[model samples]
Target: MTVTASIDIASSPEAVRAKFLDFASLPKYHKGFFASLTPLGPVEPENKIRVVFSSGQKMYAPIEHNTPTSFAWTGSIPLLFTGGTKFTQEEVFSGALSFLMGENAVARKFGFPEKTKKGWEGYNNDLKAWCEAK
Candidate 1:
């Protein structure tokens, strides 16, 4: 299932898209999220970026359909399921939530776990607050 949520950022779409493109800078504002990105080597275009977490979970998505109003990513999540841990679970679910939302409004109505949905709500709220504050 997909859990999604959206916020109407007060900033223009260009600003929103710019924020999205500045993923590598997230570590400055978002604690614990180590955004490690690398070009997809010779196999893909430069726009194809692979983002890895400090937790070892990785997400690969192209900078698809980038515009002043929208930014989208199409990619698969990697998993190495073993036993279990809080960090692992959080990483997997957070990755899924980010993929589903893509920071869009319609995703607010997407269905998923109640906790996950609430988490996205909080995320969207945070985004709105940040965008509106500046």
Candidate 2:
């Protein structure tokens, strides 16, 4: 299963993508969702970065795609899950256990999909605001 969210921003894709990649500059306008980024090591053509969220969760994802209009990284558990936490470039989440991240009892108890979706929504809005302001 996979979850995705999209938002249309009144800015060029290049401008938006630039801000998204600028993780350190994000907190100023993106609220506190993105805290900081620590370089783990050289990852060949692209390096992996550790993104620390305001919620205190740290995600170490490798840059998989970086172009003028889109950006992506793979933070996965081998065969289990992968998440990038885009716009219509839509941030994605997928895994074998992803089905459990629905409206089921346990999912509701833990706010799996809801909280995750909300986080993406907030992220999209923040990105939009920042890009438009630029």
* Model 2: per-residue Cα lDDT over 11-120, one tens digit each: 66566666666666776777645567555664322678787877898888787755554455676311111122136433344577665676577777887676666766
Candidate 1 per-residue C-alpha lDDT over 7-117 given as tens digits, one digit per residue, 9 for 90 to 100 = 455666555544545655555444333346554643223366676755577877664444343334455322111212100112234454464544455454553355444
lDDT of 2: 0.61
- The alpha-carbon lDDT assigned to residue 5 of candidate 1 equals 44
Q: Over 4 Å off in model 2, which ranges?
A: 38-46, 76-86, 89-100
Candidate 2: C-alpha RMSD to true structure equals: 5.7
Clashing pairs in 1: none
TM-score of each: 0.50, 0.74
Once fitted onto the true fold, the runs of candidate 1 whose alpha carbons sit more than 4 angstroms away are 32-46, 76-126
